[model samples]
Target chain A: DVKVTQSSRYLVKRTGEKVFLECVQDMDHENMFWYRQDPGLGLRLIYFSYDVKMKEKGDIPEGYSVSREKKERFSLILESASTNQTSMYLCASSLLDRSNQPQHFGDGTRLSIL
Target chain B: AQTVTQSQPEMSVQEAETVTLSCTYDTSESNYYLFWYKQPPSRQMILVIRQEAYKQQNATENRFSVNFQKAAKSFSLKISDSQLGDTAMYFCASEHTSGSRLTFGEGTQLTVNP
Candidate 1:
């Protein structure tokens, strides 16, 4: 089974604090993604990386950034936490294939900003 | 750009009964993929089913199956013999065959009643 591990299941941060969410995959997949899930908005893409040391902004990347320094690791960074940024964050990975494979996901990190 | 749409915000079904969740997508690409994902209270996003655009037959996984209508740009999920564990938020998503990103729609909250 493919494993996507997020560092934390729940996290709390104060406003103006920097926060990091870590994710690691054992499947050697080349593509990784970060998303925030809200009640009505669903999952909005925050960032995605297709290769090590490469990153691309997604639909809602304004306050988020990603780092993929290794094929197995992807990190999401929030420069400064805010109450509005609190949400369930998810990490996922997929193989670098043209067949459109399904992404494997982690349990997620529910971040709370106060 | 691709877009996914899930019109149903909430749905309920009795245990052992069947329920279908609807999804629609708009894209200009000829080849792509569609998916249905289930997120339980644990908040782990699980891949429920996948459908390739070129496949004429819908995809099925045990009690879960999909009704993929390519021409109509529709992909719906059918859950049979539903159980309490089947209750979750179901999300519809689309991905291009060669793209590394996925587009997700607003989710449908499913409740399984005894």
Candidate 2:
């Protein structure tokens, strides 16, 4: 079974703070993704990395960035956390194959900004 | 880019009954994939089922199955003999065969009453 582990399950931060959310996958999948899930709006992609040191912006990438320094770890960074940035964040990984494998997701990190 | 839509925001069913969640997608690519993911109270994204555009047969797993209509770009999930454990927020998503990103629907919150 694949395991995607997020460093924190619940986190609280003050406004204007820098927040870091870490994710590690045991499957060594080539693609990693960061998404923010909000009520009614569902899950929206924030950023994704296809390979180490390569990142791409997703639909909702403002105020968020990502790093893939190693194949097994991906980190999501909020430059300046705001109250509106508080939401459930999910990390997922999948094999970068043409077969279109399903993504395996972590348990998710629910961040609260005060 | 692909777009997934789940019109029903919430649904309910009694235990041992059956329920179906609807999803529609719009994508220009002929080769694509569709998926149904369940996010339970635990906040873990679980892949319920997957369907490939080139396949004529709908995919099924245990009591979970998908009704896939390639021409209409519709993919719906049917849960038979639903149990209390089936209660969750179900999301429908789509991705191109060659692409790395997934477009997800707003999600349908399904509640199963005992």
- Residue A62 displacement (Å), model 1: 0.3
lDDT of each: 0.93, 0.94
Tell me how far the alpha carbon of residue B102 in candidate 2 is from the true structure, in angstroms, after superposition: 0.7
Best-performing candidate as measured by lDDT: 2
DockQ of 2: 0.82
Model 1 per-residue lDDT tens digits across residues A54-101: 998899998777888999999999998889999999999988884646
Native-referenced TM-scores of chain A, all candidate models: 0.97, 0.98
The parts of candidate 1 lying over 4 Å away from their true place are: A98-100
lDDT of 1 by residue, B1-114 (tens): 988999999999999999999999999999988889999998888989988899999999999999999989999999999999999999999988878788999999999999
